[model samples]
Target chain A: MTSSRPRPATIGDIARRAGVSTAAVSYVLNDAPGGARIPEETRERVRAAADEMGYVPGAGARSLRTGARDLVLYVRSDAAQGPLASEFLHGLSRALRGLGYTLMQYGAERDRGLEAARAWAALRPAAVLADDDRLTRAGVELLAKGGVPVVGLGSDPERARGTGLSTLVMDHRAIGRAAGRHLAGRGYRDLAAVLPAGPPLRAMGGERVEGVREAAAEAGAAVRVHDMAYSPESAAEVVAGWREEGLPRGVFGYNDEFSGLLLGALLDAGVRVPEEVGLVGADDLVLCRMLRPALSSVRMDGESSSATALRIAEVIAGGAEVHLSPWTPVPVRRAT
Target chain B: MTSSRPRPATIGDIARRAGVSTAAVSYVLNDAPGGARIPEETRERVRAAADEMGYVPGAGARSLRTGARDLVLYVRSDAAQGPLASEFLHGLSRALRGLGYTLMQYGAERDRGLEAARAWAALRPAAVLADDDRLTRAGVELLAKGGVPVVGLGSDPERARGTGLSTLVMDHRAIGRAAGRHLAGRGYRDLAAVLPAGPPLRAMGGERVEGVREAAAEAGAAVRVHDMAYSPESAAEVVAGWREEGLPRGVFGYNDEFSGLLLGALLDAGVRVPEEVGLVGADDLVLCRMLRPALSSVRMDGESSSATALRIAEVIAGGAEVHLSPWTPVPVRRAT
Candidate 1:
């Protein structure tokens, strides 16, 4: 079907156009050893012919020859979302760019393990960065076999044990613990944590809830768990029954989005903020400030993007196994 | 450094492990027509050996032979953004996935032309989808030469006139005009449109402002331009000076994010929405509903992602040039 279009020029085509040997064309294009012996005039002619023919050095061919390319493939899943994720990506992108590497995000939905590795291996990227949820031990072995370094971001280090993959722990539990401590320290004996009733959120939500429970136990406060969907209606429904269920004086509404929703619903239900209910959210989205009573949120800080990028580069360069805890959750106190 | 690790098992390795010729292995693994004559037990043995060794058929080798891979490379830039962009992507991804195509997002920040094309061509993707701002004429031609279809999403169709790119016009001007019409029709003689004061937002912002102007001129209303940064401080500063400069009865606060910012500041400045000042925003984010006096917005409607994906698929199949206008501006009226 594409026969009508001009074919991509190969080294042989450039050589034919320049009236030189394929070896000479390669020497000129790649600037490899012995290219200095070729006359500058011949080199210029080869380059001109290559430009005219719209020749692009095949990355696939180069990868096949060198067994690696200047690419950092990030295998993305539905998890690891929100404004923080965006910030991480923008920072990571800029840092990788500075390091002369291209960051490619591959959507790995259904095929996360062995199947995903096969597809990534075809590109022959220098390294692969993936979330632990989507990465399997076998997948890491296969990619390592292909000479591709694998870095995994997860909540636990044990999951990546024996896989030869560098691990960056997100520490969502710490984030939850931070939120729990902030609210509990404010002298609220009745506390609650809102967990999203979705499969994708279940694992992370459970961890955060566990952290909140740990904090509550230490603070001598009773903890209640509320299952809420990611909808305004669900928020309103949860708020409507708060009074009868003995309204918790402090609530951890999962993340900033859910916290914002709960805050809005509480206000609509004629409940007072901090006086009636002190709320905390994670991720510290900008919406926290935009809300009526600025939200108090748990923010993952301390690790800069450049530092993370440098670590990734080190891993790609055959460095020893590294573990990074970039997300140190710090609670920012606001009106709410 | 990677020499110590075992290399990926090749087809030859599988052949040797299964005690069969490479040709027999290829036919068995590929399920080629001639493989029908091969004994079922031998085929199973070959498959078992391949599985044991974690032998994955190289997509690079397949693309080198077939000239295309089941990859749709989306060249992402900073231009197209916001929640609507996410919605479009989700829809497009689902559609492409249904077609057995893997969608890969490539970050093209500084490398937007020939340099970008060279990187994309390395993957041997079936098609390259990019914003018109990023895809140059030379880049398109080079990718076309490599037998990759180019699809561009932009505001102007003329920029892609000679590039043979399937264009999807975002029509920001139409969106602005819709907001302008809605506000003007409500009997407001003085109208204003918020334009973000950043280079990345400039082109699309300019087009949207022009659209608002066109609608204002048609209704015999005065149009005032306001350049604002993407910060609460900027919004507050703009609102603080509104009384001194004669507050416009109608205002189009760019998209929902800026609009939400403006709404908060206006209320802080004691200006009643839809009473002292009627306000509208574009993209109609969920934040519109969350705010008090639920925002009136101009939303791009009537385009299903499935349809766009289908069109893209047809284009990849070498169909004729296609122009799609999925973004039809529709003004959604709320409290303000």
Candidate 2:
């Protein structure tokens, strides 16, 4: 069963096998300019020879030859986790693959900053797609200097635009505001918003808290901010503290994971959901429906975001200028 | 904030500033063989010139010069989602990064089979890491022919070895057996193992079911297999059927996500856990602690697996032979 390994066939091998010149093989393989004028029979012979040997044109070689790259690097922040991140990646991967490009995910070096940008630039990707925190002005300039187009995604369009990147800014504040409005409209005047404590999450959490505060102020409701990790113990402590202080009956956990953890903690502490406390989460993850109270959440359309990013990347790859756009989040009300 | 983009510094620029030949600059930049003969002062001058201009050596150009690659492609099957997958990727990414290699994940083209292998080979990756189903003999041979090392991870060590791949055989059966043993030790006789219905999951699930059956047989208990999708409605239907038939008192629902979903369905159906039915999950994801009754699970050491894979990858990348290893799963006992 163990046959000796055969070497990968090269264009020269194809040329020899097809009784053609090396240049003709290269032209046929790469579909080079003026190669269409080659006799159809000769082209077919070259392709057949290549196919017989299972020859694949190396992307590195192709890029070097044509100055066209097939890689699009997506720099992910530390907070790039959960169902939302997965969905976004899947969508982006599909979209990029359709455009004959591979989406490569690189973990952002937050502390390294400019050094990280230079490292990414070293890859010489056709484009770099990143969120706000990962897309610093120096990073954009470095990438752009290397002739790689840059696209930035985040809550702040203005901040992304400041870096001169093609920006697709989604309103995370709107998600929080929607959750706040739902809870406040239900006659819950006292509310508490849970924010996951971490540098990676703080920026988004702060924006969400502001939105909650804005909605709370409009309804003459009070909002308390709780900074905690996404853990059952952390949630349990928050619940205990809320009970001790007699604070709020309505809460908006940062996202579904936090909401799920908090829900479990609340239930463990004998707090009946809705009857005792109402909760809302973001992302509207599938787990939301599986939970006892069926979590209410703000839904961001990752598919649309992915489509827009891919389109911008395609346009930029085609040497066209990019225009900025703003995306909004919608709320889905459920049992919670 | 948007300054006009500057051109990326080239080797010629570095050579000119350092008052050296392009070959000398390349030697200094790449630390080429015999570069030791270059005076320390000259090397320092070249380094300073490169830093001053923010010169980054492109991966493409470097690969061509050194005949070495920096890409370690991780081909993910469709089942690559959820906490377990995320944890595995994070661990692998960190491990590879420490070794100065980027772990690029590509979604496997399962349906395309050998054609998919050809597509991956086109990327000219330094190595390819994939699971059993995706790493076919033809794929392995094709990659090997291109001088690309292949690593396969799955339950079937023999099959993976048959393809001449560096195999890390993780026993899914052991995971299921552990779950079965835990439930049986708790005096639960009748057992049912839930297998998620999908091409990507069926192979692993089948092995797990066999393991459960083996354990059940040892304890003089009966084991039944339930095929369901990873959805709450599917879980609810299974729970409903079990209730109507009075089938089993112990169940293992694939993994924590499925366990959480099943637990919710069981609770909604008024079935008390532990007292009425014992449940177990795999992966022991964070959600296990957050779920009601807390999920009992079979814990596969993703960190160890990732480390081993990275070690094998590094060895292969350094042109060394690969050794095979067996990895076992351990069960964590909890409320359910």
Q: Quick one: best lDDT, which candidate?
A: 1
lDDT of 1 by residue, B137-209 (tens): 8888888877778888772567666567778778888989999999999999899889999877778899899
Model 1 bad stretches (over 4 Å): A1-3, A12-28, A32-49, A79-81, B1-53, B78-81
Q: Residue-wise lDDT of candidate 2 within A106-221, one digit each (tens)?
A: 66444235777887777767777776677667766666666777777663555544455676555667778988988898899999998889877777888888899888998999
Q: Write the per-residue lDDT of candidate 1 for residues A1-336, one digit (tens) a residue.
A: 434755567889999999999999989888988788999999999999988887876676776566656888888775434556666776787788889888877656676888778888877777888877778878888888766788887726776566688888778788888988998889888999998998777788988999999899899998899999877799888998897777999999999888878887888788998788999999887777666677899988876899989988988776356777877899999975
Best by DockQ: 1
Residues B109-215 of candidate 2 have per-residue lDDT tens digits of 44235777887787767777776667667777777767777877662555554455776665778888888888888888889999989877777788888889888
Q: After superposition, how far is residue A119 of candidate 2 from its true place, in Å?
A: 3.4
Q: In candidate 1, which residue pairs clash?
A: none
Interface RMSD of each: 2.9, 4.2
Q: How high is each candidate's TM-score? A: 0.91, 0.86
Best by TM-score: 1
In model 2, where do residues sit more than 4 Å from their true spots? A1-57, A108-112, A301-306, A318-327, B1-56, B109-114, B302-306, B318-327
